[model samples]
Target: MTRSAPVPAPAVREMDIDGEVTLFHEPTQTALVLNETAGDVWRLVDGERTADDIVRLLASSYGAGPDDVRGGVEAALAQLAAHHVVDLPSPG
Candidate 1:
């Protein structure tokens, strides 16, 4: 099955930890601790933006490609999701 786009920023929130790192979550608790690159992607996880938007932002911000950023984001997000750190919204 195809993965759905990430929920927009308003529906979620993020916390940046030490270094270029951050955590995404709701008001309850932190969902994940993003490493530098992953943190970059996490910072862009606004409820208003899609995963595609994050890929483009990271690519342009870090001089990378959409595929590269997308891969990293997906991997990190998967790990986070697996750990129950972040919440993927139900498709609208």
Candidate 2:
């Protein structure tokens, strides 16, 4: 079963500064800070790319192994989901 790609929440306002991202979730009134890598992953969340795609993207860009990239991306995505900065849909 393939999982749906994560989609960034529409109500988020973001600021990119010095390779980090600051996201403000309007509805929850929460502010989140993501590091350079997480910010890169966030930029790719257009509801079109799956978690595997995110891992590959980061791995290729950083010359890192897929194993190394996957965990960080997943962790960042989890954090984003927890904070309501992004939406993670379950597979049916």
Clashes of each: 8, 0
Candidate 2 residue-wise lDDT, 1-92, digit = tens:
65589999999999876667899999988889888778888988889999899899889999999998898899989989999999986867
What shift in Å separates residue 31 of candidate 1 from its native position after superposition?
Answer: 8.0
- The sequence of per-residue lDDT tens digits that candidate 1 reaches over residues 52-91 is 7777888888898788778887786666555555456565
Give the C-alpha miss distance for residue 2 in model 1, angstroms: 13
Give me the candidate number with maximum lDDT: 2
RMSD in Å for model 2: 2.1
Which candidate ranks first by TM-score, i.e. highest?
A: 2
Give the C-alpha miss distance for residue 88 in model 2, angstroms: 0.8
> What TM-score does structure 2 among the candidates reach?
0.88
TM-scores of all predicted structures: 0.62, 0.88
